[model samples]
Target: MLEAVVGLLLMLLGVSHGVETYCDGRQDGAQCYGALGGTVVLQLMDNTSGISRYQWSIKTTTTTTTIIRWTNNMIVINAIANRSSFTPSDGTFRINNLIWTDGGEYELEIFDSDGNISEKRTLQLTIQAAGYLPIMAGVLSALVILLVFGVAVVCAQKKKQNNKPKEKEDHELTYADVRTVQQPVRQMQKKAETEVEVEYGQVKFPERPQQTVEPA
Candidate 1:
């Protein structure tokens, strides 16, 4: 479809037009956005020939700090703005290593040739901490993958244990087996010895003894 092709082309090409700047101070009261821990470039003015001195300050809710102050002859960048650079010819200010505390209103005081205030412009700058989400997501994904791999390894070990062959049991002898191994009596005695003799007899009685007893 046409939409898909357009989307692919947009991805292949970049989002930049001729120049990229956090804020443009061509007019007064401009607003700018910068990413946290990133860099921001500002176009302060079209030309810096008429300006004698340029003083830039950032104002927060509680305090205000001078970031950079420069003149046509000498340029002095503050310690807090150590990573910042400015071009006097084109009035472009580039700041690096942005933080959350850097979000506030910035005031640029421009002085004329006679040391008179020519223009005092204030621009609102907001810093977004949007660069860390992708990092956090990637770490979470890696941890999830490691956990899944560990679980799979443990499951594989258990399956290997289940599929392994069992060992054979030892064969021990029982009481019945011991009895069968002993020798049994092959034959009994044919006759037993007699300790005493047994006897059988027959007796006859006289008849005369009965007649003598009748006379008496």
Candidate 2:
């Protein structure tokens, strides 16, 4: 009975150690895209359990270069010519100012305190030219909106100017709008007659009649 129990325990241990390790770039189609002179970060997706050290390296077609080696509370640079950083607590690695030559397969190895590799992750990194279409499109859209607004304002001003002459012409008054002209004559046979004229638009006329008469 004790032998059977030991055999079951050994089988469970083997099964536990046989679990596969998987790597993901957290990007579309499991590919990481980077730009020239930009920063690239490789993040660990697994939960931090018994991790003690981190090893980051880049594999090119003809060479494999170690970038960083990090242990708990310690960090070491292996590639002195390249700018790289490592966070040991989280097993995260960062590369600064990527160039065209930086494009390669990046490998990350997490080890326990016993120097045994606990997990390994590899991701392909590609560096390409930076994109500027979004920024240029935004600038062009703002320019177009401003141009349309300016044109609308100019058209409104021109329309107002054009309507001014027609308004003035349509507002002209005829002779019937004014009060009628009348003359008052007194009983003097030889005096010359005096007349008064009234105008439109609020001009006051004389109330008293002049004492002049026309010859009968």
Candidate 3:
């Protein structure tokens, strides 16, 4: 049971992390461009438990539908770091300034502490055509705006839901002013009773003593 509970908690935490990362578009693919011969930084994630090592390489396909390792073209930009790894810890890798020949597919391989290897993740890097960056930027900006707007709407709905009962309570209290109106009616009734009592006391019983003597 305890193991199950721990597993459940881990799953929940993982899901929450994924949601936060993806909602902000942070978990998406790493971006690199080969325009004008600039270096592109690529990031790698373990996406699993345990310490891992990372390797990066590039390859090409032959016309006969076979992949050939390009030993001469392979570049080791970084060595295997300890445990978890992310690329270009400080910043992006810059290619040779203004070179167009650097465009290719970059591959990242991960190995677990137990020596279990993962399939390589590859990113296609291409030199951008003129005006391509602007279009990509606009699309990314629009997606961000839409996500922010959706979150705002959800928050507003929650706030309105929380305030609904309070508004209803205020309306109910306003309508219950009947108690205040009845207070004056009670006071007026008491005042009328006092006036009647005063009038009765003012009327004296006359000749009560003479009537008593005649009876005697």
Candidate 4:
């Protein structure tokens, strides 16, 4: 019973601490996505009414490193000591020529001359090894292959259709060749009919020989 009570008290304390931490700033910690060899900018969103000194740190799973320290002047340190720059006119941290080693949780802690924390912002960056080109290329190649295959299929179907035998026409004298053959046949029939014998004199029947019938 005592252990359960203690556990409940610790849990309440943790929740209160989380609430205070989240309520410390106007905005929550930001999340940024980046491609390999791209640039990233971490900006403090608070109204810098009376801030002077600013410090930026990057924390990985293994180590925490300070990247920027700014007061009257600005300085970049550690792994990003060369690639990082700061703009005092506006509290912006720009990291150019990003590498895969740069992916981590970045924290910006700002303080005034009185050593009061004006704003604390965290930016989480996730870096990808490759950009969109590889996936797009694969999809485009697949589409082109499918298009080529579709064209080949359509062409094959057309060739097969063209190679098929055509149906014979049953028309006898509808075409010129048919009419030419029929004209010769009709003329030959007419010529044969006209050449038959034609009688112009009166028809004479064969006379029967008279038979002598003396005894009768």
Candidate 5:
């Protein structure tokens, strides 16, 4: 677990140890490393007080870019060298957000106030996709282990849920709807208060005479 964590941090942080590169210019000083999208700090000189002017440039196969230069006590950072900073006090040049193209040999030229040549030094920098691969085998192993552990946890949870028996469905109840309709009641309307009930008698007329027509 610790190894996995360390590997992950290395891959993410791009953390690497920097060797103290002096202004010897004799030894091709040990190489420094910068991680992609990371930062790198290079020590150019011990003291800036002795140096009246200095220039730093990185030489790559395709092109050479001036990272920073100081002259007449004025510091001028190259327009192309973005995210690069230099401190006159410590003579340290820091570059952030490194890219693959930044890998190259860096050279420093120091001059005195009298325009006299001083000492020169050079250092190499390597750009890696990750912080340290040989140390941790990159981030692949850690990611794989994490992925496997996550999948196992998911499978275990699914198995637990499947093992739990579903409760039997409750019996469905049948229902019959009953409805009653009421007959309408007739309402009598009131007329005049003195209106009496009138009754009509049946009139019957007796047969006047059974008149037979005499045969004349």
Candidate 6:
């Protein structure tokens, strides 16, 4: 029974040495945005024991397969990896002068001398052109400019409205000035009509003047 228990313990210890997954450069499956001719880092790891060699590969949108190598626990991709060379060190992969073509999925495999292979770890990389950033900036600037112009136009319209006089007020003032200037002319015309009326009502008496002269 003791021998059987010892055997079981050994088996458990061996199983514990199986390959484990780890990402040192980028937190497992993190996103990185890079511009043209920019550098980005990739991370990988095999946490479990019994891992003697690591094989790294990349698959691009072009459906091309690239085999990566391990030297001194580092995966190195020379210029042959792509148009730009990439160097991996200390669980970190450095991509030099990234290009749009460099965007793709990267797979890492850890292998043991005993022919035990671990599950592949995948990391996604994205590369963009420097021009794209500038275009976004220009769009934002245009929006700001349009907003300022709209505000200025609204302010100018408000000022114009405030400066103008109301139509009703203007008409009332004009009518009042006209009536004041014509009042004196209207009064003189009324008096002339009254004197004409008195003249018409009166009659001439020539005999009255002759009697007055005889009495004197």
Give the poorly placed runs of model 2, Cα more than 4 Å off. 1-30, 35-41, 45-49, 78-102, 112-118, 128-131, 173-216
State in Å the error of residue 214, model 4: 29
lDDT of each: 0.67, 0.60, 0.46, 0.60, 0.64, 0.58
> Given candidate 1, what's the lDDT at residue 123?
89
Residue-pair clash count for candidate 5: 0
Clashing pairs in 2: none
lDDT of 6 by residue, 89-196 (tens): 245555665667667777766766764675566777667665345545645565566667678889999988876767668998999999998998899999999988
lDDT of 3: 0.46
Scored by lDDT, the top model is 1
Q: Rank the models by lDDT, top first.
A: 1, 5, 4, 2, 6, 3
Against the hidden reference, what TM-scores do the models get?
0.51, 0.51, 0.35, 0.48, 0.52, 0.40
The number of clashing residue pairs in model 2 is 0
Worst 10 residues of 5 by lDDT: 174-183
* Per-residue lDDT of candidate 5, residues 17-52 (tens digit): 321222222235647777766677777776578567
Q: What lDDT is reached at residue 160 by model 1?
A: 84
Name the runs in model 3 displaced over 4 angstroms.
Answer: 1-131, 175-177, 204-212
For candidate 3, write residues 27-144 as lDDT tens digits.
3344455433222333344222342454545545632111122122232333222211232332123333323544465665555566566555665556544423544454556556
- List the lowest-lDDT window of 10 residues for candidate 4: 17-26
lDDT by residue for model 2 (1-216), tens: 345445554554444322222234533234676666556666644434455677767887787788767666466556743576655455455667667887878777778789989777787877766433333454456556666767888999999999999877666543334422212233232233222222422245365567888899
lDDT of 6 at 62: 66
Clashing pairs in 1: none
